[model samples]
Target: MRSEMPYANISGTAVAIPVTGGSLAALVRLPTQLPAPTVICCHGLLSSKDSSKFAAIVEDLCQAGFATVRFDFSGCGESRSASEASLLGTRLRDLLRVMAFVQEQDWNNGQLGLMGCSLGGYLALLGAADSSSVGVKALVCWATPFDLAGIRTALESGNLPHAMATASRQLGEPQDLAGLPPLSRVLVVHGQQDATVGWRAAIEIYRRMADPKELLLFEEADHRFVDPACRNMAIQASTDWFRKHLAGSP
Candidate 1:
């Protein structure tokens, strides 16, 4: 049996975006008594708040005295699947909104961190890697994809969703939020044997990142991290990243 990880619905947005014509929801898990730092969890492509993997991470973080908020990307989960036609930009905007929401919550005044898996991981670093990531104190990614255009090219010959290209092409150079110091801290964890997204992508991302970043390569791990050791490693590294940065540790 899985140990219970207490989580409560913190708030819901009536209109996530007017263009999407739907609402977005966020569920929060707070550390006991004294408020704790936060990890904004973003799920991967085609996944949602319903993903068991995300739930497991959320539970782990919460149990470790860290607060986390996980929400469904518009058109991905309970929010609005029909809006997928406009998905690419919609998800990025949704991430921006989620960040805004996390900063506003009562329990998140402390350092804010991010944990995103796969595609989610890509966007997390992309968001925080650039100067725009306000309130983003740290980042954790797993087998994250970079170079959105490359992914699009791979799918061009297939019947893959057209929305992928439409959105990837337009997400643009991430916004360089004015007035904020450059984002210098980052942590990336990827499977060296990942065949789906491949290890090359992760290395490429690592190169694009600035200093103060660490990448954990799981030698025998695959894309899903299905192996018990790999899964445990992913969890440990992610939790460790948050604890060190969010708690201001050396």
Candidate 2:
């Protein structure tokens, strides 16, 4: 691990995790406190661990005494591209691997939280629902789609990545959030004006989930939360949610 001090009270480490074909590039940031609660962040379909929104949230999380892990899901950012035929499955495995890696690290306190954006959010849900993710205490999904069907047009038109388009064909039917097992504490944030994925997806996700859930809709924000103010609000809310749920984990 390559370590550097990003802040007076926080340190950042760059690490490469081995996967099927190649290693996934990741950055692990921790506060001065040892054995801190950790939050693993997943980027969007076309985004990376270095996303401004993700960076902001990671900084906030670290300042709040939470360690954060940000990594690229194969084919995006610095991670090697995965096979087009197994893009979705490969990404899921990647997340599970990262989760396991974090759990084994001495800095982790056995308490875990997950945060994901867009497609990453969907993957986060899948990861949290898996039997192996029993240690996950909370989740924050931003601009997450309840179903993948809505993006078929974008996938087909080449607006999205070819790997996802190909994987969608193999998967056949789109999976919905309702199919996921009962989730832990969840926070669903969306923008009412989101053109990519409608706001109703957020409602569906919120409704399908049990208690300890919340939905935040920004009237002027788009799918990416492009507005500076809206993005900051979303980050603050997510950081606060993780703080509440993970910090209180028993």
Clashes per model (N, Cα, C within 3 A): 0, 0
Candidate 1, residue 11: how far the Cα is off, in Å: 15
Off by over 4 Å in 1: 1-20, 81-86, 129-133, 153-182
Check candidate 1 and list the clashing pairs.
none
How do all models score by TM-score? 0.78, 0.89
lDDT score of residue 184 within candidate 2: 57
The per-residue C-alpha lDDT of model 1 at residue 219 equals 91
Clashes of 2: 0
Instruction: Report the C-alpha lDDT of model 2 over 1-250, residue by residue, as the tens digit.
Output: 4233343334467788877777889999988888889999999877899988888889988989999999988777778744445446677888998998888788888999999999889899888888865578999999998887755555556666534624544433335677777685999999999998899999888887777888899999999998999999998999899888888878
Residue 123's lDDT in candidate 1:
70
The TM-score measured for candidate 1 stands at 0.78
